[model samples]
Structure formats: C-alpha cells, structure tokens
Target: MPHRKVGSSIHLSGQLPFKDGELLGQGVVGRDVELETAQELARHAALNCLAAAVQAVGDLDRVRIVQMLVFVASTPDFGEQSQVANAASELLIEVLGENGRHARTAIGVAGLPLNTPVEIQVICTAV
Candidate 1:
C-alpha cells in the first residue's frame, strides 16, 4: 500500500521524485547532482507524499502534516541535507499554509532506491 491509516494518523511510504512516471534527478548530492537539482527533487518527492496523503484520506484539507522524515542520497561530504529538505518543507507550507508546519528529520544516506537524490516519508493527521 502507498499509505496506511490508523485512527487519525496516516503513514506514507517513502516517496521518490517522480514526474509523469519518470524519475527525476538521480545520483548523490554534492557529487553527481547539484544542490539546486536535489532541492527540486526534494520538493517533488514531498508533493508525492501529499498526493498519497490525499489518496489515503480522500480529502487533503481534512489533514495536516504532523511530521516528516527526509532521506537524501548524498556524498559523505555533503552537509546540506537540511537545505535540501527545506525545499520540501517550503512546498508544504506553500500548499497548506499553517497546517503544513511540521517536525522533520533530514538525513544523508549513502544511497536510495533508484539512486534518486531524495526521498520523503510523511506522517499526517486528520483534522
């Protein structure tokens, strides 16, 4: 399943940066991919999370993001995981306003599925 719901909480599987069924940027940040591209990937993944949340809940306005875990495929020297994740956070705020504010964890990973630069998982609650 793309997401699971229990009571008021919804848990989404890791979302990758995909557009029109095509994977977006790939490779490790601070190496094969630039920071800007990685940021865009992050935003795209977050949008996927929101889309999954809507599919799970049937209505997006009835839910608010509670927390998020962002994994960035990056070189060991990359120190901008938070910066990459910020793009997603910003997108959430842009789409949901105050309801989008959330606790988040931005982590750098050695690799990710499909070598995608970023992946995101979201937790939301029905309001």
Candidate 2:
C-alpha cells in the first residue's frame, strides 16, 4: 500500500522483508542478526518493491528501476551495508535485466520499523 504514481514515475515506500505478513529477520545487524540473513532480507524487500511497482504500472516488463535506497539497521561496527544492498541489486538485475540497473544509495540506520533489519525503497519509470 506504499506506492504512488506521479506522472510517469512510481515511488515506492520503504519495504520490509515480509512474505505473507511474516517478518523474516529482525534486530540490528552485527547485534542480533547475521550478515547472510540481512542479505536475504534485502532481497525479499527488493521483491516487495518490484511487486508494488507492478501494482502501480500493471506489468513488470513495463517498469524500469531508476533509483533505489537501501536502509540497514546495524550496529556501529557493521560496515557491510553495500554488500547487503548488493543482494537486492542482484535480484533486480536478475528479474528485470538491464532496466533494473539503477543509481543506488546504501545507508546504515540505528533502527527501522518492526525491527526489520533491511528496507528498500524504489523509484521506477513506467515505460
């Protein structure tokens, strides 16, 4: 429910790693969550972003990712934010091919909603 269209662009709100309303991973990375789990969660969140795009645009084939922002809930010493984000990027490319290549920013945050370790926000153009 966190997607909206503006002209030719679709903006998706931060998506957590939930499938069927089940949170896959929780807590801060390097504190209560492992790197591998965080990576998987990132992929899941990215999928959710794509799903929202599909909802707004009606087809995955017509959507091209323009930019993405990944948020990681991690401890002070955790510095692998980019690696965690890579998982999401990889999924996008695998799913959408070249159109999925996008400008991206990965950030570490103290916390996120529902204690989820990974969140992804996507902006796409309906082509």
Candidate 3:
C-alpha cells in the first residue's frame, strides 16, 4: 500500500461565514441558505467546504485535488444533489483553474450537523 503523507490527510472545515442565529428558516440558520431548496443548500455547502479546504492548505499552488464528495441532508423526494454538487465543482474550477477539476460524488443523507442541508469533503494531493 502506498503511504499517505500527513499533508495529504489534512482536512479542513468550511462553514458559510453567515452570522450565527441569522435564521435560514425554521430549521436553518446562516447566510446564503435556502430555506426550502435542497439544490441551493447543496451549492452553498460545496462552496463553503472548498473555501475551507483551500484555506487549510494556506496556498492554492500546493493543491492537487484528487476527489470531491458532497453530502446533502434532505427529505426523500430530493433528487437534485448532483446539481447542488456542481456548485462546489464550479467554484473549485474558478479558484484552482484546470487543476481543480476532480472526480466527484454527491449523495443525499437523512440528516447532518445542526440539521444542515449539506456538507462536503475533498481529497487532495499536496506538494
């Protein structure tokens, strides 16, 4: 097995810098939140996650994203997780250029932290 370096294992947390208790509706709180739309929430989650990941590295030049996964907490009828995941994918390309393009997966789950509508993770190769 190939050994994974500590740098490669580093993970970052990204939450939309919305003010606390701003109220995204009955079950939501924070800025850029969509009260009734899963797609919008997914997009916000992806953007926030990527921003946090980039900040974790402290420099964009050291990044080589290998994969991305987005998790959407939603009701059973939600079928647009992939579209929401695109929000993250698009933002990464904007920030990292071609290097940001990556393998990705988007999934819908029953629930998440603070009843958040979305969360994301990234695997990156670091220099």
Q: Evaluated with lDDT, which candidate comes out highest?
A: 2
| Candidate 2 stretches greater than 4 Å from native | none
User: Which 10 consecutive positions of candidate 2 have the poorest summed lDDT?
Assistant: 1-10
| lDDT of each candidate versus the true structure | 0.94, 0.95, 0.61
Residue 87 error, candidate 1, Å: 0.3
Question: For residues 12-122, what per-residue lDDT tens digits would candidate 1 score against the true structure?
Answer: 999999999999887999999999999999999999999998998888797699999999999999999999999999999999998899999999999999989999999
Runs with alpha carbons beyond 4 Å of true place in candidate 3: 1-9, 13-40
As a TM-score, model 1 comes out at 0.97
Per-model TM against the reference: 0.97, 0.97, 0.68
Q: Give the alpha carbon lDDT tens digit for every residue of 7-74 in model 3.
A: 45645443432224342322332233443364455555555555555566666777766788787665
lDDT of candidate 1 at residue 98, scale 0 to 100 = 88
TM-score of 2: 0.97
From the highest lDDT down, the ranking of the candidates is 2, 1, 3
CA displacement after TM-score superposition, residue 78 of candidate 2 (Å): 0.7
Q: Model 2, 1-127: lDDT tens per residue?
A: 6898888888999999999989998899999999999999999999999999989889999989999999999999999999999999999999999999999999999999999999999999988
Name model 1 segments beyond 4 Å from true: none
Pick by TM-score: 1 or 3, better one: 1
